[model samples]
Target: MMITSYADSALSLLPPVVAIVLAVVTRKVLLSLGLGIIAGVILLTDFSFTGAASHLVSTVTSLVWDDGALNAWNLQIIGFLVVLGVITALITVSGSARAFADWAHQRIRNKRDAKLMTMFLGCVVFIDDYFNSIVVGSIARPITDRYHISRAKLAYLLDSTAAPVCVISPVSSWGAYIIALIGGILTAHGFADTGHLSVFLQMVPMNFYAIFALLLLLCVAIFGLDIGPMRQHERNAQKGELFDESKGLPPGATADLPEADTGKIMGLFLPIFVLVAATIYFMVSTGADALAGEGLPFSVLGAFENTEVSESLFYGSLVGLVVTIALTMQQKISTSMMFTGIKVGAKSMLPAIYILLFAWTIASVIGELETGKYMASLATGNIPFALLPAVLFLLAGLTAFSTGTSWGTFGIMLPIAADMAMGSDSTMMLPMLAAVLSGAVFGDHCSPISDTTILSSTGASCHHLDHVMTQLPYAIIVAVISIVGYTVLGFSGSVAMGFITCSVLFVLAILGLKIATK
Candidate 1:
């Protein structure tokens, strides 16, 4: 309040972005984000370095105490990891996951189908990327191996779909995060214009990264349109030249080898079915405004529905888990085996959890430093109006790639993106923000130090370095298309144009690849 004049200079460097660069350099996400947060806190205050340190600690304590304000996506990150661990254990102990794998291996004809279906299944499970990663790997590994699809490709597809699909879907976990993110923006600006939550909601369909990458995955699947380095990797994978099976797999073991008694395949399916039913129920309850009408205020199960909407996905996961546990006994799997899968699954998310706490620390610290408002004014002053989206995208991409974390990117980027929209068309803001998100996803998709990258390598049983080298070329190819798509979108006069142009480029890209292969 006293020195609003210093806000811009104070925000010369964003905390998360710095952490991202540091993470890439050091390969330590937690360390980078923590340091950045500390720096941001120091910058915001007028006090000495010691005073800044004291201020950050005090602010963090206050924010953490609020519980509700510790970033809206907190539970989604925490619960998804824990639940996935439990689900994995249960699915494995029941031998049901193995049966699903056996069925997939039997049906797939070749390596293309193997990787393709893994990607397809990833899209289908779009509600949560974390869920998608563990579940797809849990379900598709066997089929991938039948055709000798490299574990690397399988992990890439899983990693690819995890964020891309969610960011695009209205009812997805990504959508939930964005809504909360933009809602905070609306609150900050004191704007009541329906907050353009719907604007961003609408723009998801137009997001180039989400639309194009998915289409690319499909082309890889159906038409066998492998190209650039991904094709070379796939070829090498088949020859066993760049990969080895003797490493004995890693991370949430791929469902490639059969451990289940096939006759009871249906027995293994109950947990998955139950989980899906619970997710749909959760999505509706939380995003229930769409279902609400002029007269319908309270749901029939108002207490249950109300509980779901208030507590994020954590409450629903609890309910879903209980149902899964109860059903497990009916399936007659030993309790010990289910617990084992849960432990394994939870362990898988450890890296993400580490990044999350550090990210939170940094964002809160930065916020205390008044860096967001500072950067906003500077960007408004110096950057051209037309170039804003591209700038935001580059910033977001750089942060994500360096930090090896999309959520951390969101923590840093969303606030500034939201600030850019103030006093603007809002329609412009939505696509611009979407561009930022896609850019971050693109960066994480290929970042070697990223958790998903590690998980993909582990899930596919591919050597980590090889997966990085092979998948990078394809990531770059799509990134170029996305850049052009976003640029065109920046100039687009209407949201519809943005949507159509992005969709066309993606579809054409898919079709073009198919046609060229023939």
Candidate 2:
């Protein structure tokens, strides 16, 4: 129902490719993304400098007041990030996180246990990736540092769980978004009875990358399978050196304020527990109403299907922030001190906010350029049916990597995935859909410009480039396994056997890597 200004052409790929290349080469993430936006604007304006400048102004301005900025989903997510930042700051300044670290110090005794504990925390916060990365990094850094765990390792743990876990969780923000996208496509194609949530559940078993990534993370954590740059980083960490001095730590690393040791772990435990409970409550109640409004009988799963994930997350984060502030106040902290913490916390999110704006704007520009449609074209024609899922996986991975945005890649590829499967056997549909999801997350997991990657670095206080470099080898290993798994599934046409085959292979791969690294 939207009009695209540009015809589907090869030029649509240039903007994101330039952005990716520049980010990798320059190591200036913000600058690289900004240049990509400019390139996209120039392309959209027919290659006129004056036109591009004018269009850039209009587009950037509109993000503040119109489509990108005024969008309800966008606002909800933005509010959640700001409030989450404030809550993180409040806990840090109030010494709540420090108290929790002290409380955990006894339970998590060794370096391996510390890493495992961080991984557990990451898995627990599956409601939203943004929330997961920020909360886990903020809370676990002190604990990890106490055990000589490197910032790179912490970033990997944070990044690995943030997106991969959300993509698989049935009630998380990511699940809601994917359901909405897939539902719309299915409804349009006359599959009105094919519930999107049902399809999502079916695809969960086939989500190879997400499943394998978590398994691999567990292997790395429990077995200490440090390889490539991560091994060097871990070696440095054991010597009480967390980061390479030449690269320097990220700005605002001071967010981990010095602890006062009040020993009130409630400051940390209460806020997080409340955040999870509140988010679940909002998702259920909001989703219940949405389903009832449509006159559908409200099953528990149906309620989640209709929930407003972003709005619920915003409310949940806001409530959590309020509770954390009140807890800090009870510690006899001055009003000015609490407000100062809020300001510092909000300011900390500015870098992430900046990248998100440019990323969203570039995605909008790509949509207008019909980039997805152009890529979809490549999947058409007489291709071998047995290799379709594998091919689509690589294509989706490349698209997500180039753009540094998984949601954008999903939006672009999901329809094509569905359409291709529609022409063939219906059994292929879920695998194809799963492939798109897996591939998008795989690419996002590795991309330096990805918002989750940036947040992971910010949370862990690791250099952004170090996180990407260390995580890439791990991500690639899982990606290769997924590609082969999907290819075999496509040919065999057996989801159950495919699941067993991939699961066994994933385990074997992890064990092999663990031994190899040792």
Candidate 3:
């Protein structure tokens, strides 16, 4: 029953394949993930039904309790989500969201302006994707709704901006994580003198997908370009159907809750401002604490590299919830009504919480299966130097898509990419690494089981499947252009040429979509 024995085998890929296929066909995320977990456990237990059941129980419990202690990271993230949900509910019940929407309606005259505002918020909240996805969606949803923009489209805006922005920002959590990993890779490859932050910054321009995805999102928002399933959603939104009601209410939805007429814009803006400020403060403080413990000097980058993201998020959200509750009370809302908001808010998050739990569990199982290892192995043994970047991008994308995690993909593929470049083409190291970063983001962006994707849908109050299906074509288009960029970089050895290629292709793709839709 040692799963490592099958790490390099084709069998390692089965669980995610089954899960993804079932999700696409059935549109039942829990069912797909549940079956996927069963599939993984079955593989681990060597087809022993009893062993599989036991393993499954242990895996589920392990999320909360692992290694004789509570799993603080996972629990804190869950806590953050719950608290944020409550804050969202309080905001809605106090009529702050409605007030802000009404206020914006007078200034922002159309769907394009509403979406552009969402995109702008998404970029500004670049500290963490989780924060960006949820907060931006909450802030923008009412305005977008008033402008007749589809929930799915709003989710797309939230998602396309969240990870893509975070992954590139040096001050963000994703940047810290990636930079630390790059430092290790550089050390291992005997480039210890090189600055990790510099390398990350260099990779920023080389991250074709992230750059182009953001551009594409801007185009979609400003030019009103809708592609594939997105077109249908936008059309429906124009007809006053923002989302398919048959799919049930999405997470963070407050439509059924009563709104107080006394609500003010400060009710929404103040709590959100507090949440953002508190989260950033905690991030720097925690990072500084960790650095001090290590006998190191305090620096912004170093602190970010050592910050506990989930813990910081949880603490900040708790503060945000407190402020929201106080604001609601100021509106003279009854205790019973406040409790109702709390209950409904917490309940609304259950679906996202459940999906995230299942995703984390299955991701763990996939790790044991060595799904990433097997996928990484395929990229070895004599790939053309000219195609290395493209191949690595594709491979990393595939690994991330299958595993539902970009961080996991980075851990697995970054080292391998370093080794590959060191062995045959030393000059390609940074580009190859950049390609992995782009690919990992691309894959995670598209994967239905990805936590960010789930949160994006939850934040926008859109059906998860609707968000996934609508966003896929757009992600793929950007990815394709990114592949071409990597390929050009691999061959031409010019970063500018590669980026230029992606930018040109991106513009063409957007224009073509604009024309075709017409």
Stretches of model 3 off by over 4 angstroms after superposition: 1-4
Kindly provide the TM-score of model 3 when superposed on the true structure, using C-alpha atoms. 0.98
lDDT for 464 in candidate 2 is: 79
lDDT per residue as tens, model 1, 1-518: 22423344545355656765676576455576677867666566654688777867766565345544664455554666566556555555566656666776677666676777788778888766655676567667657755666666776677777778877764565666666666676677676566445756666765777677777776676676766656766686678643544544344442332233422455446655666667667666654553364345654332222234324345555665676566556766555655665666567555545554555566555444445444434445677666677667766766566556676677677777766766565657676777778878887887655656655664454555556666776677677777766666677645566556667766777777777666
TM-score between model 1 and native: 0.69
Query: Which residue pairs show backbone clashes in model 3?
Result: none
Comparing 1 with 2 on TM-score, the higher-scoring candidate is: 2
Q: lDDT: which candidate is best? A: 3
lDDT of each: 0.62, 0.82, 0.92
Tell me the TM-score of each prediction against the true structure.
0.69, 0.91, 0.98
lDDT for model 2: 0.82
TM-score leaderboard ranking: 3, 2, 1
Compute the lDDT of residue 347 as modeled in candidate 1.
71
